[model samples]
Target chain A: DAGITQSPRHKVTETGTPVTLRCHQTENHRYMYWYRQDPGHGLRLIHYSYGVKDTDKGEVSDGYSVSRSKTEDFLLTLESATSSQTSVYFCAISEPGQGPPEQYFGPGTRLTVT
Target chain B: SQKIEQNSEALNIQEGKTATLTCNYTNYSPAYLQWYRQDPGRGPVFLLLIRENEKEKRKERLKVTFDTTLKQSLFHITASQPADSATYLCALDLSRDDKIIFGKGTRLHILP
Candidate 1:
């Protein structure tokens, strides 16, 4: 749990529709990340927020956007949902300089776009 | 391109036996390596981490060995139980990257 919760545990959306997944953390960790996991391909980072209003792109940051308006919330928005974007999305939180920098992840949100 | 590779096929081990898994990487110098366990439909849980300077790290029945020279890591579970059946992912962090890269994972089945 790690005091982390993601809204819409499961979602089914049509192609070209807008979708937003929310990640809320009570631990107030400075670092939060968004990752998508699919078959064959492992977990791939889509976007990460280092601090309030500070974000960076990861290896696979295309067709996706993120926002961290508050310390407890990180939002992932798909402007136009596509079938290729359907997968399990996980939100992880970690504190910098915390020994090994291990991340605590939320349960995950399973999104399917048809 | 940087890459990390783990056992592509599922590994089956008998109960009470030691199960060893391998992780190999190329084209990258990682500051540390980590192992994570993920059950179906659940997020990954961190198992252990080994630094490049450390040869081996142990926690209870779990042990991780890091060989920088070989650019490999070996994860072992002694006295394995059926409950340990899951996918184990090997991830690495580079000194220059803010995010960790992960291998697809090796699914281990502890047959009872």
Candidate 2:
């Protein structure tokens, strides 16, 4: 398994509340990504970071924000939680220039917004 | 917009038989396609990757075939076992954007 870990492995928050999830990696990979998985929708990219302080939005970046101040940590924050946002969040890491760039994912964080 | 489609239904295969899964896409052909496996509660783990130019690639009991003309990819697991039961996902690179899109995944059950 990759040396990646997500904090607050499980979280339950009420609607309109602030929620934040953290992803930490020891691999020092240059690329880090946040993804959300739901039934029937599969996995959707939320945000990604290529290097320190460099980030970009993904296909489903609405209502979500991410910050990568350091190479080892990436954070995802939901300003106000919604029931539709309830899903399993996964953090993945990849090292570019290392061939095909296969991503290694963490255990994932299951978030429930009611 | 690019779309990837995989059978949403679960597939049942007997142990020691071969299991094949299909992934079809619409839009431009990707330079690289990847496969991953996920258990019920865990994140996906990378399995195999095949490039558009390559017709087939193999690793251990797994094989991946890419057909650019058909805009599809096939994943096969031979000599299947009960332990192989899980959801398999297929992902493809979106041109040279450095980002890949994933399919909904197909669940496979290896009945013993």
The two-chain DockQ for each candidate, comma-separated, is: 0.80, 0.87
DockQ for candidate 1, C-alpha atoms: 0.80
**Per-residue lDDT of A1-114 in model 1, one digit per residue for the tens?**
799999989999999999999999999899999999999998998999999999999888999999999999999999999999999999999886866788888999999999
- Provide the TM-score for each candidate, comma-separated: 0.98, 0.98
Per residue, candidate 1 scores C-alpha lDDT tens digits across B1-112 of: 8899996558999999999999999998898899999999999999998988999999999999999989999999999999999999999985455589889999999999
**lDDT (10s digit) by residue, model 2, range B27-108:** 7779889999999999999999898889999999999999999999999999999999999999998766678899999999
Q: Which residue pairs of candidate 2 clash?
A: none
Write one digit per residue (lDDT tens) for candidate 2, span A11-89.
9999999999999999999999999999989999999999999999999999999999999999999999999999999
The numbered model that scores best in lDDT is: 2
Tell me how far candidate 2 lies from the true structure as C-alpha RMSD in angstroms.
Answer: 0.8
